[model samples]
Structure formats: structure tokens, C-alpha cells
Target: MSFYTSLNGLKNAQTDLGVISNNIANAETNGFKKSTVAFSDIIAGSAFTNPKLMLGIGATVEAINQNFAQGPVEQTGAALDLVVNGDGFFTTRSAISGDTLYTRNGAFEVDDNGYILRGGNRLQAFPTDAAGVVSGNTLQSVQVPPTNASGAQFAGVAVGKNGVITASYADGTNVAVGKIALATFLSPGGLRQEGSANWSATGLSGTATYGEPDSGFYGGILSGALERSNVDLSEEMVGLITAQRNFQANAKAIDTATQISQTIINLRT
Candidate 1:
């Protein structure tokens, strides 16, 4: 029982170490957020031989949560490179499939198809009219049409802090295309975790509320910049060492318990 308890501790420590390693590895990944492992104590049995609790079971992983804290903003000199000055995510549609996913990383490129995509996902820009007016006022969903190469330089491309997009001609002519929209949830932490540093809305998160960046409740947009990863290398290293020590200590305990069991068995032999 003692050996099993120690084994549980080792498992939990290993899991925590894995999470720390991932944070360190993604330290350079743009818009990456570090995750922390939470542990819960497990009880083996009630205290019978003594007044104090025996406390046999060690620990188990409770959850790994995303830290939504903002990262550093860096300029890349690319017009399409975008950084949120406050809070919000960039929505993108999958190239292969039309599924949408949201992210804070704004490192984007104009693909051969003329659709803006970040990290291989085609960015969804809301459609505007000839006058370049945003179709929906934060109440509308954005759709990206197939690129027309002969199309006159994205006539309606306006980007607002609170989800406002203003499109114009390449020759410095301004037009009111559409307003960019932001989504806020009742409980952001309640959102479901999808790998690749993405999140999916859940019941706990409630429905997303749309707004324009920096206009109302949404954050403003900063062109030619990107949000850096929030992972702190020094902090992650410290966590790694602590988890290692815990793992070693638990392993030693298991070894000691094994020796004790062996001695007891030898008495009969």
C-alpha cells in the first residue's frame, strides 16, 4: 500500500513535469499561453491504528488550465501582422474544412487564393458592400468568399479596435467595409480546452457576446504586431526542478517500502 501510494505521487509529478516541459518548449511560440497542473490529495483509508490520519494515497492530477494573461506585443513590420491591444481572438476558417477556430496569434499571410490565413487556416473576413459598409453591426457573423484575383484590392477592408473594419483602395482611398467583432463569455475559464492552444465554447462559458475592438468592450487592433507567448522560461525551469525533486523523493519512499516488505518476507524464509 505504501509503495502504491508513492507510485501515485511519482505519476502526478511526472505529469506536472510534462506540462512544464511543454511550456518551456513553446516559449518562443507566438501567442502561446502556459498551462499549470493542479493536484488533489487522495486518501487511502481511515485512521484506525492511530489518532492521526494514515494518509496513504498520494496525489492525482486535477486539471490543466490555460492562463489567459496577455503576452508581450512585438512589431513585425508586416501590414497583415495583427496584435490585439487589449483582449479578443482572431477567427479563422479551416482551409480543408470550413470549420472556424479562434486564436490570439495574428501572424497571417495572404494565400494564393487571396484569403487571409494564419497558421494555415483561412481567415474569415465579413463581407461588405460596394460602399464598404460592414454588413453586420457585431450582431452578424463573418464570412469569407473565394478570392477573385481580379478583384480590386479588397475594396472593403476596415479593421476597428472594437471589431470595426474599414476597407480601402490600394491607392489610399478609404471605405467603410465592415466592423470587426469580438466575443466575450460569461465564464471564460469554463470554456472547453481543445489542443493546439485553442478553446471551444461550453455551457459554462455561455454564449459569446460580440463587440468591436477598443470601441465598446472589445480590445483595439494593432497592425504589424503580434502577441508573444506568455510562458516564462525561468519560472518553468523552477517548476521543473521542484517537480523532479518531488518525483525523486516519492521514488525513494517506494524503494524503502520495498526493502521493508522484502525483510518481512525473509523472516518466514
Candidate 2:
């Protein structure tokens, strides 16, 4: 029974190590959130010898929660690169499917369709007039391969502080298209993790409120910039060492218990 408990401890420790390693590996991933493994004490059966004291089975990994602290803001020379300074995400729409999604990573680029997409996903923006202003809380549908302009070229489209999108024409004329929308969740931690650094809203996440970046408490949009991952190397290293030591101690306990059991077997022989 003691050996089984020790084995559980070893398994839990290894799981923790894996989490830390993943965090370190993604230290350079933009908008990556670090995760911490939490453990809970596993209690076995109560001991008849003492009613007040119950035997502990061991500890097991309980949950792996993301640390959503803000990462360092980086400046990229691309006009599409944006970093959210506070709590919000850039709303995007699927190109082929037309489904809506949101992301914190502002690293954006114009695709073949002349629409903004990040990480191979089309970014949906409300269609704007030549002036780049949005009309109301509702978003207007904007299709890529923008045909409203004279030359059908993606030129001089800029996102402003009020979520306004202004595009310049080939003749050096400016037009207002539409604004980029930002979404904020009631509980960000409750969001479900989707691969490719995207998150889907869940029941626990609550409904997401959409607005423009740099509007109504939302942080201003920073063009030509990306946000770095927030994983702290020093802190992770410390946690790594602690987990290692704990594993070693658990191994020692198992070995000691084995030796005692061996001694009894030898005496009987």
C-alpha cells in the first residue's frame, strides 16, 4: 500500500514536470498563457487504530490552470500587428465558413482575399464607408477582395483609436470602411482552449461583449506590434527544482519501505 502511494506521487510529479516543460517551451509563443499544475491530497481509507486521524493515500494532479497575466508588449514594424494592452480580444470571422471567433494575438496580415487573417484564420471586420467609421453596436458584414474602391486594391486601410477603419485609394483618396470589434468575456479563465492559440467561449466563460479597441475601457490598438508570452523563466526554474526534489524524496520513501519489507522476508527465511 505504501509503495502504491509512492508510485502515485511519482506519477503526479512527472505530470507536473511536463506542465513546466511545456510552459518553458512556449516562452516565446506570442499571446501564450503559462499553466500551473495544482495537486490535491488523496485520502485513502480511515485507520481503525485512530478515529481522529485518517491515512492519506497520496497527492495527485488536480487541475492545470492558465496564468492569464499580461505578457510584455512588443513592437513589430507591420501596421497590422496589434497588441491589446488590457482585457479584450480582436473579433474575427471565418472566411470560408463565415463563423465568428476572437483572439488576443493581434499579429495580423492581409491574405490573398484582401482580408485580414491571423494564424491562417480570416479576421472579420465590420464593413466601413470611405471614412472608416462604424454606425452602431451592430457589426456590418465586410467581405474580402474589397470591391468598393476604384482599383480593388488593399491600400491605406488603417484602424483608429475608436475602432474606425480608413482606407486610402490609388488616387490618394481616403475612405471610411468599418471598425474592428473587440470582445470581452465575463470570466476569461472559463474559456475553453482551442488549438492554434485560440479560445472558445463556454458556459462558465459567460457571454462575450463586443466593442471597439481603445473604446469604453478597452485598450487602444497598437499597430505594427505583437505581444510576447508572459512566462517567467526564473519562476519556472524555481518550480522545476521544487518538483524535482519532491520526486526524489518520494522515491527515497519507496526505497526505504522496500528495504524494511525485505528485512522481514529475510528474517522469516
Leading candidate by TM-score: 2
Can you write out model 2's per-residue Cα lDDT over 160-236, one digit (the tens) per residue?
66656566656666676667777888888887877566787889989788877776777777777788889999999
Q: Which segments of candidate 1 are over 4 A away from where they belong? A: 44-56, 125-134, 137-163, 192-196
Give the root-mean-square deviation of each candidate in angstroms: 3.7, 2.6
Per-residue lDDT of model 1, residues 5-81, tens digit only: 89999899999999999999989888788889988887655446553846546788998887888899898877667
Instruction: State how far residue 235 of model 2 sits from its true place (Å).
Output: 1.3
Local distance difference test values of all predictions, in order: 0.71, 0.77
Candidate 2 regions exceeding 4 Å error are 45-51, 96-100, 136-154
TM-score of 2: 0.88
Q: Could you estimate the TM-score for every candidate?
A: 0.83, 0.88
> Model 1: number of clashes?
27
